[model samples]
Target: MDYAGLDYRNIRFPVDRPLTESERAARYKQESYSNASPMDFLSVIKLNSNSIDLVDRWYPIKGFNTWFGICVVLVSMGALAGIYSALFFSNRTAPIETVDWIGVSALTPLFLLLTLGGWWLIRTECGRFTHYPMRLSRKTRQVHFFRQNGTVLTVPWDSLFLTLGESKSPLSGTTYDLRAHVLDDDDETVRDSFSLGYPSPLGNAESIDKFWAFLQPYMEAEDGVEKTWHHLKENTGYLVPVDNRREGWRWSIARSFMLGAHWPYLQLLFSPFLGLNALGRMLAMSTSKIPQWPADVERESQPEVNDPYVLTWRDNGSLGWWELYWPLICTVVGVGAFVGVIAWVVSGLWR
Candidate 1:
């Protein structure tokens, strides 16, 4: 497929295009404050027939990184200090109360656990932050990690293991992590590692998977290992092309929910509320074609026009007001309810 016109793939970093004042400002804002979108982080740079570059320029926004670690440390410290002051310094004349001891006893272990966990997280983030612009070169079959001190560590492709790491949260379902680890001489000890930072729960599995699909073609593996890996990759549903126009918002929601449900069945219970948000997104897309791929690539990847299921919304004609308005109302209500529940839970926690 010809990707000559693709905004991401075609552009070189330190992008050559001249920027207007506003564009420059926007660029600076993105660099300083905003996280790089999945597209920007994983966008494949085809250097030549044998070489491709996958660079990691941003940290995963949603994880136990430096910011989260700092919050944990600050909160735990304040709570512990408050407890200590109330117990030891509030009234010097009063005998040490049993209740005070109980409070201290109860909170001490939890506080220690949180503090230690947060410290570990801080160290991990420090390592990641000090290493930026991690470059993986397919041609050299080597992954190059660029450190802050003008040093680079290169590990061959065979010395690395690519695996998916996942974590589950009550509020956000399950999040997937794409990580690469470098093995030591024993081939068992992990010498170094880094996450590629897609964080799939935020409707980004498709994008992450697409990036993985691109890498799989270049990755070298033994015959048996390659076959097993390919089978697993195909089952991941990342290779499936989503036709948003034909599938509509409903289909998108169903697909996302199914992905969630595949790992955790609890997500199935919330499908109704989730479907509402999905419907709203689909309604917005109804007004225009939501192209998931570049023109040439889309043309090449999509099935033949004669396929029975390829009819788009345009081909099927517009929905009547009766068909759209009811769903819109339900979606608004679902969003409101979801927000209210969150606010109530947060308020209770604050109190």
Candidate 2:
């Protein structure tokens, strides 16, 4: 049941309802699944109100509090400390301009940039529950897209691809990862075919197989000639070297250096830097559930749009908000801390 309350604050979604069935059918017959149905694009909000307790995010199976709770505390503490320092101390090197104060001033731009950008992005997540939809359909291998706790998509049969075979997992006997890709191109160059998460029954190979059978029809030859697909090798849990630079050797060098140069920036893009993890997480999570069905994906097709059901929902948690407030928060903290340094410096300079 849906909670009645709705929250409009910090919501962002742009939807153009699919044209009426008759209209869509006349426009594009092959792609149209239902003459009566149209693509219903919407953003749902949940809040605690007299009507109902509002919508909270959902994580399949089980999960806990978002980073917002912890982040707020950390931010508050940091802000408080900076305030204390700014009001009390001074710097030794620069008596006239306290180093602490100047340093805090330096962080202002970064925070402002992050906050405004983040607030703008919140609505695009486009769902009611915080947790992603975690499930597998017994009848159809279609991927379930949930928004406001309702199924928004029945992954087009042609969009899903499954690799069915014997693959042993560390714990589960044998498993198949229900792989799917969107039929369309992705927004970024890095991922032409984005991955949706794994189904609920990720642990058991049998369940994975059931998922495979349903998604199997969507499996088309990724290309006319054989090449390495991103989701291969993992199906058997065996390491087979592929001819691609995205993973393995070249990727390591790029990832290593990029991380070293900008780790702090990268750290903020995910949920709490990987805070809460679950047991059998792969089985429970969607990304973990689908193993890339190994196809001969040519390196030339580095960014290939092989399928259409690519799950590309992104949740940066409160980082966007955090980033927004970061500059302000950091400024407040820095200013507070800087003031302390200035005080110490001025006192000494005068003395």
Candidate 3:
């Protein structure tokens, strides 16, 4: 059969193109010789790949470290204070030497108690998360990441106007490698998969250009998918042929730093850190929903031409603060409070 015999030119979209028969015939020809793998249509897509809301992980280290660190130090100091009180208050006449040793002994148990309790809380919070998949769903403009309870988180993709793939995170200094694949209704073949480097410091520009690298073979295979993919990317403007090294809004950093990063939906709080995250989401929503303000990429940038396919990807690993983390935070705080109370009581007894 000739490359033009498939006659698949009926499809059209909001964009300005369609799949002609020649394209289908060529695709068929390649299929005849290709050893394509089974498609992995994700039952769920990772919602917030680039953002904190989409991926599940231990709380970002900075906040957790600082907060938890303070708790630990505070409790330790309390233990020491409590011991001192125990020693001096027992009889007010005990030798100073005896007093010192007794006081130190009192702290030993307190230290052990707080240490174990804090450890348990942190561990418990970090383990309960099992499913944390996210997807930008260019088609739906929705961000979906699963929660610890298996309830899916659905947020509008417009909530993040900037999501360029980055190999490096300013906070963790951890580099990320991202990949995407198109799934058939049955997920038979990864019709297309590649990377798009965003314009950022922690990003790899060379990697951004690589999207089309993996995509070209598929691009030549079908016209609609290429056009649709490009159109979507363009409209989102979060994506680019390569990462743009733009100094993203400073608010992005402040937001990323606070609330230990988002966990799906967040109710507002007075905390500026929390507010920062809200602001980031608001900015994203604004960019995506406001029609008057142009999308970073225009509809013209991504057009419809050949085949249209849905793609999904995973960070392929676990990460920061979440529902599981809350309990951990609470446990540490509880221990600190407990020790503070003990110290206060002992100080009074000694006096």
Candidate 4:
């Protein structure tokens, strides 16, 4: 994996190739079983004579409509306004009755809470999706974080640490979050951190290891004593998680759908907002079947061999036919349902 000459930023580097009998035997001897699959690495890695740059970006998943977020906000606000108008400002000709007053009083607080909650959710989504990407530079030995508002924070390479955080859900099993943190001058003070939260399925430790392996080589090359090596050794793994029974695109999509369905049942009443989020994720995962691996990972201990199966960006297209179908269906259904709801509400108001 000599990534020195490869332009990882614009290219889709192939992380797997057909192994020869000798190679397979060698790998089997090294590890009895292989847990890692042929995965794709979407991030960009640029190498220079004196430095390397890695950029992990948040890309809109294929089959997931980004515009759905806008639709969700608009429909929610519209519904809120409609409800308020219906409850609080009904026709003057129809004298305000005791029951009407009671209804208004009861529903007003609920409406207000829903309005505030919707706004907060919209803001959170915008922050998560539209924020700047994470950039790491080896030349300067610094990691630069760009905020949504164009602000940048730079942290020294030596100060950086990888933290693994876990969350358990009774319905969806356990999910892990990989976070990058920077410690302050005293090394005891924590300055800043960011996370690529729950990037893969449960038990897929290889994804986390691959992400860390990208930074490990550069970090180790730095001129001072490394404090994070122990952390690295602890987190890194040789075996990938495997299940032969559940394989291929169909199984992957089913697993993703089940995971996405983990939203609390109580939240179903707020389907307009929560449903869109889940639907977007489901579509994205279903359409993108290939797993992604980190590019330019240093394998210093392995023998050098030219790989003939390497793939370039030009060889790949944006989305395949099957991948495009589900997203199109989701878009049509989402739009149709949205329009029908609006029409029904407007008709009820007229009545």
Q: What is the C-alpha lDDT profile of model 2 across 168-208, one tens digit per residue?
A: 43433443333232333331111111113233223343443
Weakest lDDT window of 10 consecutive positions for candidate 4: 237-246
State the lDDT of candidate 4 residue by residue for 1-351, as single tens digits: 011111123232121232234322222111122243322233332323233333332332211233354454565566667766776576667766888778767766766666665554334323332223444554455566554334556666555555553445453366444555555555444455554323443334455554444444444444211322222223321111111111233322322233233343423333343335445444443333232222332221112245222122223344433333343444345556766887898799678
Q: Could you say which candidate leads in TM-score?
A: 4
- The C-alpha stretches of model 2 lying farther than 4 A from their native spots are 1-65, 80-85, 88-98, 107-127, 130-144, 147-151, 163-177, 184-351
Of candidate 3, the 10-residue stretch with the lowest lDDT total is 1-10
Task: Identify the superior model by lDDT, candidate 2 or candidate 4.
Answer: 4
| Worst ten in a row by lDDT for model 1 | 1-10
How do the residues 1-351 of candidate 3 rate in per-residue lDDT, one tens digit apiece? 001111113211111233334333323221222233211111122121122112222212112322343356557666666666656555566467865676577767878777666554333323333223343344444444443344444544333212122233345363322323233344343332222211122324343333223322332334434543443344322221101121133323332333333433331222333333323332332232111112422231232353234322322222235422432343344445555776797689657
For each candidate, C-alpha RMSD in Å? 17.0, 20.0, 19.9, 14.8
Q: Judged by TM-score relative to the true structure, which candidate is superior, 1 or 2?
A: 1
Task: State the C-alpha lDDT per candidate.
Answer: 0.43, 0.28, 0.33, 0.39
Give the Cα-based TM-score of candidate 4 against the true structure.
0.50
Pairs clashing within candidate 4: 40-291, 40-292, 40-293
